[model samples]
Structures are given as structure tokens and as C-alpha cells.
Target: MAECLAIRSALSSALDLGIQFLSLKTDCQVLAKAISSKRTVVEVHGVISDIFFCISQLKGFTCSFILRAANVEVDTLAKAALASYLVIF
Candidate 1:
């Protein structure tokens, strides 16, 4: 759910910035697969719906999964945000 919200928020920001192309990378394989398939399990259907809606606004977009080790920067930021009880963009 957090992954979906992050992706949706990022996409919304990109759209607001008039970005026509985007390549989103994440460490969550399940989320990546769900986004690529344009479907989600019932548990997160609402969030995925929002994600897909944001995706549809993009001219070009790609979502990919990277190993957690390769995403250390984001992981660190996420941990920091959690520690601070705040949300990271």
C-alpha cells in the first residue's frame, strides 16, 4: 500500500511538472508486478486504482523493480521518514 501511494504521488507530481516521460523504480517486487500487470489484489485495489489513474495521465511511463541493495538511498530515506513519523514525497 505504501508502495502504491508513493508511486501514485510521484506520478501526480510528475504530471504537475509536465513530465511526458517517466521511469519509476522500486524495491517492491509485488507492487512492480501488479503495476506492470495493471491489476492488484483486493486488499490494495483502491490504491492500485489511484496508481493506474495517475499512470494513465503520463505520455510514457515504465515501472521496474530493483534489488533492495541497489535502492539503498531510497531505503535509507524511507527509514528516516518512518523514524520521524512523516511521509516522504
Candidate 2:
């Protein structure tokens, strides 16, 4: 979740620098569903709520849910990170 927030903030900052159209893609089904629903964010992720709200400000952005097989890079990286985290602590 923290990583998602950081990426969203960076993307927003980039978009601020004269972007015409932007589309966000995420493998997280929950996040994609939540944003597409255009409903208020729940308090569960209160710390990251601001970042989610910031996503609403982007123009022509669409959030999508992709299957694991279709998201090899992200899925691989997530698993690698999980493995590394476990190894570290």
C-alpha cells in the first residue's frame, strides 16, 4: 500500500508537468475496483486515502484489474519483494 501511494504521488507529479492524457494501470483488483467505483475511501487505508483521492484529479485516467498471468512483471516483482522482506526480517 505504501509503495502504491508513492508511485501514485510520483505519477501525479509527473502528470503535473504538462501531460495531456494519463491512464493508470494496477494489478491490485481491490484498488482498481475501489477507484472505478468512485466511492469514498474507507478508513482502513486512512494514511493512503489522500493519495487515492489525488488519483481522482487525473484526467482521462482509468484503473483496471488484470489477471496475474497478464501482469508478469508486477507479479514477479511483488513476489520477489515478499521473499526479500521475509529473508530480511
Candidate 3:
């Protein structure tokens, strides 16, 4: 929840500054299910406490679901960032 809240806050800040029509892609099927339906189950609470917060922040954009393979570049960049953070510490 804390992690998701931080991301939601960051997204809110971006939107407040006029970010619009951005392309957001995700690879998590469960996440896709939640966003597409605008509803979640009890298990979703554990997975996405801040998802609704982020959804409210985006008023003019769309999010897409992509296969993890199709998101390899983003995956690699994220992995690199994680590795770099580890190395830095």
C-alpha cells in the first residue's frame, strides 16, 4: 500500500502539472483486470490500495495492457534501475 501510494502521489503531481493523454502500459493481468473493470475484490485491496487514487489522477489518458514480452524494453530499464539502486547502496 505504501509503495502504491507513493506511485499514485507521483502520478497525481504529474497530472496536476498538465500531463495528458499519456500512454500507460502494464503487464500484470490482475492489475489489468482491476483497471479495466474499475472494481476489485478483497484480494485486490492487498494488491492495489492506491490504484483508485491513481485512476482519479488521470482524467485524459488511457492505459493499455501489454504482454510482458512486448514490454521488454521497459522491463530492462526497470531491472537496470533496480540493479543500479542496489549497486549505489
Q: What TM-score against the true fold does each predicted structure earn?
A: 0.80, 0.58, 0.57
TM-score of 1: 0.80
- TM-score pick, better of 1 and 2: 1
- lDDT for each residue of candidate 1 in 1-89, tens digit (9 for 90 to 100): 55565666667788999998999889989888888888776877987888888888888989899999999887666455445445433
Evaluated at residue 4, the lDDT of candidate 1 is 60
Q: Whose lDDT is higher: candidate 2's or candidate 3's?
A: 2
Query: Candidate 2, TM-score vs. the true structure?
Result: 0.58
- lDDT of each structure? 0.78, 0.61, 0.59
Task: Name the candidate, 1 or 2, with the larger lDDT value.
Answer: 1
The weakest ten consecutive residues by lDDT in model 2 span 1-10
**TM-score, prediction 3:** 0.57
Model 2 per-residue lDDT tens digits across residues 1-89: 53355445555676678664566566777767766775544643653465566665666666678876787777666566556556777
Residue-level lDDT of model 3, residues 1-89, one tens digit each, is 22233334446677778885455576656565666676664654743556666666666656567899897776666466556556777
As for candidate 3, its clashing pairs are: none
